[model samples]
Target: MMGTRRSVQFGDVITGMLVDGVDGTPYVAATLLVDEQLGVRLEVPYITTSDTAAGETPGEWFETKCPPKNLLLIALEGNISLFDCRYSGHTVRHPAGIAVGKITPADVVLQDRKGDHSDPLEVKELRSDIDGLTEWTGFTAITRHPSVDDENRVKKLDIELRTTDELIWTQGQADMALRTTWSCDSTAEGLTINEGVMLHSTFPAPVPVLTHLEEHRKVASLMTFIFGCPITWRSHSVRDQRFTEKRFSQLIKQNTVKEAARPDPTEKQLRHPLASPSQIGSSGLEAWAASYETWGRFIHPAVSALNSPRTTLENVVVNAAVSMEAAGHLIGEVDGENATYDRRRRKTTATFIYRCLARTGWDWSGICESRVGLARALAKNYNTIKHYGRGDFPDPLETYLVSSTATLVVRLLAIRQAAPDATSEFDSGRHFPAYGRLVEDFKNNGLFIKCDGLFAVSS
Candidate 1:
């Protein structure tokens, strides 16, 4: 029951008292500073006493005290638990006889504390809204109708809809729910409507906040995989059902450690998601979750590389190629035919890529359009850059195409393995135009013929 208030943003400063130890320990007045890229830091100022005037400073205090690595900061806004904090540096004011030392935390948790407790608060449920999740879920909670006067001029509009909260999946002692919430505001200028998706997790028993956070991250990663974007938590709140003193006291707003900065996709870019809830259906989602749990070691990094905004084409190509090779080995282990053949001779990277592409039932000829197989061409390019200093580098444009095609192939293989029924939906979706574009680019650049020759020399 946390109130609808704006959450803390980067660059905001909160004044508080830093606690070094358990009860009765002396506290230092400090300020918590949030950074856009460098994460959270605590600044504590030290003043010189009459006897030690100009002799002791904040740096000396830190060195002498050797404060606990993990400290707590208590403030009016909330209590921040700083973990793995390290002394960054100190700024001295010689004339004022004061110095301020900075402590950077590896992890930070900001939470509202309602009452005093000897032990840490236990979290029973966590609810978080992810950016771009509404579009990814494709669940609409609002309908609009325009009203016009007899003059045929539109005067007002009527909006009607029902909020949806449905249980999505359940495992032993845990379950996940999807909630679509909407809000409408009428202003002087016009009416504004906003819709968002909130993911909720309920545990059988109350657990520590860190445990709840791990659960939240697991679901967020799944959303990131399906949404085909770097999904971030828009808001997060936790509740303990055991606390029944008041509605507001039962729920607390919390912010975990900030994630690394990455490029956010535009609205248009989000329109063409890799997969949607509506397209995949409930069964498909369950399958996807299972697949991810089993194959995440191979799948996660590839998806991250493909969707990363700051990486080079060479980096993306290498990551995608490695993932494909790993996935191919996994596939061979499960399929009897491939397993038997592998016992005689280890499968090549090209063979693995070729087998994965075939499983997707996707026609590679459309993109490759080369005498050499698509797998061989991709493997050759991967080796060219992976084993650099041995051969002439590929053209930049060609490398771009190879990176794009390899990532797309990896995506296809993932979907085919997780939800074969959704392959048709994916083929007819936004990827159709993308596939066509790759074909045209290859033809225009004459890479189709050149790729075949490149493969021939490597063979």
Candidate 2:
């Protein structure tokens, strides 16, 4: 909680005593559970207290009867606070003190104090780590100091790297930077090097803790789209300028809670990222940041579908298609096209696909031989899945190819709009091996014929 640390995952259950944030009233025994679907919840059971001042008579009290106040759960693992809790339901009540009820919270915060504090902590800076960020950035923090023998042969070598902070983006008074840090350890067997990327944000003035966290999430979303994966926050902390005070808070939103920890992509796996450090350069990243402010509404759906671990093949196709359609309308308007771009009289999906492909100058003929055939196939498949309920879904293989193709198309369009000069690198097979392989897969598998009837008509 002080710095970067492992975050709690779903299905973790912590048992503790529940205390009311206001008036400091201790409630009955409770358990805090995080679920993939149900989200963060607290289960409290009725309790019988013999400390009644009225007499020797014991009374039973249901924690559910307590007012809807922010509650704190003190467990051995850590202290967590539940905010905006409401009574969900309860079980059988005949057992008096043993009946159990549920409380659903709109947000959950870890390592936070009792919620009665009137003055919230002001955040001067926020720092967090995302999975695979180090690899995606292609930055290193390790340096080798080698000592040679008298014969010029290597004798001893020491590895060391200093912590570095590089400015990535600045918007008015607020600026975002990337911090790379390394640690070295000498064990009985050998030495080990650990490196990571920390996303750092500094505000012009002390901002609300929630605002600091929102900024982190927004940047993480943009990185996810660029990296072509679910770049979830591994750990985070909010602190003052001098790091004298540190606070940890997590918002338990639907998207944040359901995110699963995916392993970082290996060097081989990252052979063809949608965007890279060398490709984006320093100035290009700033341009990308600016572009995201305007185009994020068009890009988020595609990013979510492509990166979500639980996304189905059908969802990938439908989401990619919808995102491309929306983005195409904007691109057309930006290019001063005469077509009226509106929801009521919308252009066909094929028309949008063609426009995006043309704008990016992406060579689609390698995949389908004919660009027209490819566009028609994608549009037909998308329309069948989205508009017709009776149509059969595409086979798993064809669906995968179509999803991959759409993802690449989206990336091309994004790069073109953000950093037009970098778009040429995507065409080189030597530069983007993954892109070449995808095209090769389409050629080998004959995706054109398969996608023609991607969604079969039901008899």
Best by lDDT: 1
Ten residues in sequence with the least summed lDDT for candidate 1? 245-254
Give every collision pair in model 2: none
lDDT of each: 0.64, 0.63
lDDT of 1 by residue, 317-365 (tens): 8888888887777776333224313345766666777666666566666
Candidate 1: the clashing residue pairs are: none
- TM-score of each candidate structure, all chains considered together: 0.77, 0.74
Off by over 4 Å in 2: 1-96, 99-122, 152-157, 171-173, 182-193, 206-210, 227-229, 241-257, 261-268, 333-347, 389-400, 427-431, 447-459
Residue-by-residue lDDT tens digits, candidate 2, 1-459: 323222456788888777664453445478988886776778876534343343211112233244354666767666666665667776654435335677886556565552243334455776777766687676778779999988999999887787787547764355777778666788999978888877777898877656666656555755666666556666565555422225434445434555534455555544446776666665665666666657766677887885685788778888888878877777774332223223566556776776776666666555664455566667776776777674686566777777787777776776666567764556543446556788677666754533332322222
